[model samples]
Target: MSHPVVILGTGLAGFTLAREFRKLDKETPLVLVSRDHGGFYSKPMLSNALAGNKTPASLVMKDSDKMSAELGAATIHKGRTVAGIDTAARVIELDGGERIAYRDLVFAVGADPIRLPIEGDAADTVLSVNDLDDYGRFSERLDGVTSVAVLGAGLIGCEFANDLLSRGISPTVIDLAPRVLPRLLPDAASERLRSKLAEAGASFRFNVSVSRVDRAGAGLKLTLSDGSVLDAGLVLSAVGLRPRTGLAAEAGVRVNRGIVTDRLLSASAPHTHALGDCAEVDGHTLPYVMPIMQQARALAATLAGNATPVVYPPMPVIVKTPACPTVVCPPALDASGAWTVELTDDGCDARFHSGDGQLLGFALLGAATKQRQALVSQVPGLLV
Candidate 1:
C-alpha cells in the first residue's frame, strides 16, 4: 500500500512541504487541498505591488493545475473547507460531504486579517489586502482615489503608505500607539521613520482612535475620539493578522494563539503536524515566509522518517517600507528587557539588550539597516 499524505492549505508552507517531500518519497501518494484558487504567489509581493508596477495577475507565478502537474501530486481545488478531522481514524471530512484518509497530515492554514468593529456606512469602505484576490480587488478601486486613510501604522501599513505615495496618492496613517511600529521600533527609531515618511507626504495621527466612520458624499469621514474627523477617498485596515486555529482547536489539537507544535512540528495528534502562520512553535507564531520555510524543511524531514528537530535561527524581518527602509527583530512580547535607541542623521538603530547587556533584539532603519547582519549575529538562537 502506498503511503498517503494530506496537506491542508495552498500557501507557502503547503507548497514548500509538498516539494520537499517529493524529493525524498516520490512514490508516496500526496493530496493537497485549498479553499482559494490555489495559485502560487509570493505573499510579500502584495505590499510592494504598486511600487513594482505589477498587477495581481502579473504577480501570480502559477495556478493550481500547473503546480499540481509540476509536482506530480493530486490537487483538490475544492472551495469547501475541511470541517473536521478524526485523528484516531486518520480521516478528514470536508464540508461538501467528502472524506479522505491519510497516513500523515499537515496543517498550514495560514491566518486571517483582523477587522475592527466600528459603526459607519464607511466601515464597509475599509478593506484589507491579505491575499492575491484581495490585492486584485483593492487595486481596481485605486484608479480614481486621491487620498487614502490607513489604519494601523505598523509594518504593513507603512508599506502600503509607501506604495500609495509611489503611485502619487498620499496616505494618512492613524494608529492608537504614540509611535509608528510600536511592536518593532524603539521610540527614537520610530520617530526617525515617521519624520522620513512625513517628508515624503505621509501624514499621521498618533495617540488617536477612530470612533466611527461614515460615508461623506464622495469620500469617507472618519471621526476620532478627540472630536475631530478626517476625510479620505478610501480606507485600508492593516491592523495585523490572527492565525486560523479554530479548526485545530475543535479537533482537540492543542492551540494557543496558533496550533501548538513541538520542535519537530508535530501536533498533539499522532502522525499529524502543523506549520506556517498556523503553527505555534515554542509559543511563537511567525507569520513570515522565512520561518515558515524553515518549519517546512524540518517537518518534511520528520515526515520522511528523519526525525529532524526544527532549529529556529535569528530571523530578522526586513520591513518593506522603501521610503524609509526599516528592518526589525523585535524581542519576544513577554520578554522582560527593553530597547535603547540610537539615532543618527541618516537613520535609526535600536538595540534590545537584556539587563546583563546581552543583545536580544534590534531594529534598524534607513542607513542604519547595514547593521542587520552584525546585529543578527549577536542575538541568541531562537531555538536555543
Candidate 2:
C-alpha cells in the first residue's frame, strides 16, 4: 500500500488542502491529526460572533468523522499530538510510541494568541479566543459579564470591542500604541473609526498597557501603566498571534517566525510541506484566509504531481468593525512609500505612494471603502 498523506492539523489549511487534493486524485489515502475535537469552523467568525448571535456549538460546520468522509481522509485522529518527526525515515511518531509513515506530510498547526505578562493573580483568567474550543471557554466565562476590558487596539481587538458593544456590553479597549490599528490604518482613518466606536459605547486608552488584573468584588480591576484603573466583568487579551513552530523546530525543520516553506509550500525536509498560520511561505507569514486559500490550492496541485508555485495577489483585509467599516492593503515592509491622506467627517481615504508616485497601498474607511476593488487593481501583487 502507498504511504498516506499525513496532515498535522484539521484547521482551514489542512482540510482545504485535503479536499482540493481529493478533487484531483481521489484515491490518495489521507490522514488528518488534530489536538482538539477536529471540527470544521471558521476561526474568523469568532471575532464578530456576538453580533451574529453565534454560539460556539453553532460555529462548528462539521465534526471530525463527517470531515473525514467528505474530504476522503481515511481517518481524522482527534485529540492526538505528533511527538516527533524522523526526516530520514520519512515518518512521524505520535505520543505513546505510535508511528506512521507518510508519502507526504503537511503542517497546518495554526497560531497561538500572545498573552502579556501582567501582575496580579487574576491575570491567568484573561481570555484570548483563538479556536472554537477557546471561544467556547470564553463564552462560558462570560456568564454574568456586563463589561469587557479588551487589551490591544489592532484589528481583532477593535472588532471584538464593536461586537461587545452591539451585544449590549460596554467595552474598554486598552492599547500600547498611540492610535488604533497603528500598523494598518493612518492616523486620520484610525481616529475616524475610534470616534465611531467610542460613540457606540466603546472606550479607548491609547499608549497604555494593562499592568495588572486583580479581583475586585464581583468584577475585575485592571490597573493601567499610567496609574489609571478600570473595572470590568471580563478581561480579553488580543495583543497578537505567534505561529506554532516549536514542534517543527524540534523535529529539525527550519523555522523562523513560522515553519519556513518555499513557493511550492515545501518545507526544509523532503516530502514535508506547510501551510496556513504555521507556515512562513517564502518569508510571508500571512495569517489571513486569502493567503491560505492560495497556498492550499497550490499545494494540492503540487501533491497531485503538478508542482504549482503559490502566487499572492493584492489582498486587502476588510476590518470587521461595523462601527466604522474599513479596508486596508498595507505596503510591503521593505517598500519605501509615503501616505497621502484625504480625511473627512464621515470617511477617510489614505493612499501609500512610492517616490515614483505609484500607489503601493491604501486604507479606506466608511463609504470610502466602496472603492476597494478599483484601488486594489492598481497595486501590484505581493508575490507572483
Candidate 3:
C-alpha cells in the first residue's frame, strides 16, 4: 500500500494546505493529526470573541468528522500528539510509541504564547488565549469578573481590551512600551487608538512591566515595575508568541526562529515541509493570515507536482478594535524610513516614507482607513 501524505496539525495552515492540495490532486491519500479536538475555527477571532458573544463551542465551524468528509481525508487523528519525527525513515512516532509512515510530511504546529516570569505565589494564575482550548478556559474564568489586567499593549492585548470594554468590563492594559502597538504604528496613530480605547473605559499603564502577581481577596493584585499596584478580577498575559520548532530541531531539520524552509516551503529534510507560524520561509516569519494563505497555495502546488515558489503581496493588517478602526502595513524591519503623520479630528493618516521619497508603509486610523486599497497598491511586494 502507498504511504499517505501526512499533516501534523489541524490549524489554519495544515487544513488550508490540505484543501488546496485536494483541489489539484484528489486521488492522493491524505491524513491529518491534531493534538487538540481537530476542529476548524478562526483563531484570530479569539481576541475579539467576547464582543461577538461567541463561545468556544460556537467558534468551531466544523469538527474532525465533518472535516474528514469535506476534505476526503483518509484519517483525521484527533487528540493525538506526535512524540518525535524520524526524518531518515520518513515516519512520525506518536506519544504512545505508534509509528506512521508517510510519503510526505508537513509541519503546521503553529506557535506558543510567551510566558513571562513573575514573582509571587499567584503568578501562575495569569491566563493566555492562544487556541480554542485556551479561549474556553478564559471564558469560564470571566464569570462575575468586572475588571481584568492585561499584560501587553500589542495587537492582541489591545483587541482583548476593547472586547472586554464592549462587554461592560473594565480593562487595565499594562505594557513595557511607551505606547500601544509601538512596533506596528507610529506614535501619533498609537496615541489615537489609546485615546479611543480610553474613552471606552480602558485604562493604560505604559513604560512599566508586571513584576508580580499576588492574591487579593477574590481577585488578583499586580505589582508593576514602577512600584504601583493594581487590583483586578483576572490577569491575562498577551505578551507575544514564539514559533514551535523543537520537533523540527529534534528531527534534524534546519531550525531558526522557526522551522526553516525555502521559497518552495521545503524543509532541509527530504519530502519534509512546513508553513504558517511554525515556518520561517526564506528568512521571513510572518504569522498573519495573508502570508499563511499565500504559503498554502504555493506549497499545495509544489506538493501537487507543480513546484511553485511562494510570492507575497503587500498585505495590510486590520486591527479589530471597534473603538478605533485601524489598519497598518509596517515597513520592512531593515528599511530606513521616517513616519510623516497627518492627524485629524477623528483619526490620523501616518505614512512611512523612504529617504528617496518612496512609500514604504502606513498606519491608517478611523476615517483614514479608506485609503487601504490605494496605499496597498503602491507598497511593493514583500517577496517576488
Candidate RMSDs in Å, in order, are 1.5, 1.1, 0.9
Q: Which residue pairs in candidate 1 collide? A: none
Among all candidates shown, the one with the greatest TM-score: 3
Q: Name the lDDT of candidate 1.
A: 0.87
TM-score, per-candidate, Cα-based:
0.96, 0.98, 0.99
TM-score of 1: 0.96
Deviation of model 2 at 147, angstroms: 1.0
Candidate 2 lDDT over residue span 46-68, tens digit each: 99998888898899999888888
Residue lDDT tens for model 1, 71-125: 7766555566897999989999888778988999899898999988878877877
| Candidates arranged by TM-score, highest first | 3, 2, 1
Query: Considering summed lDDT, which 10 consecutive residues are worst modelled in model 2?
Result: 68-77
* Candidate 3 pairs with clashing backbones: none
lDDT to native, each model: 0.87, 0.91, 0.94
Using TM-score as the yardstick, the better of models 1 and 3 is 3
Off by over 4 Å in 3: none
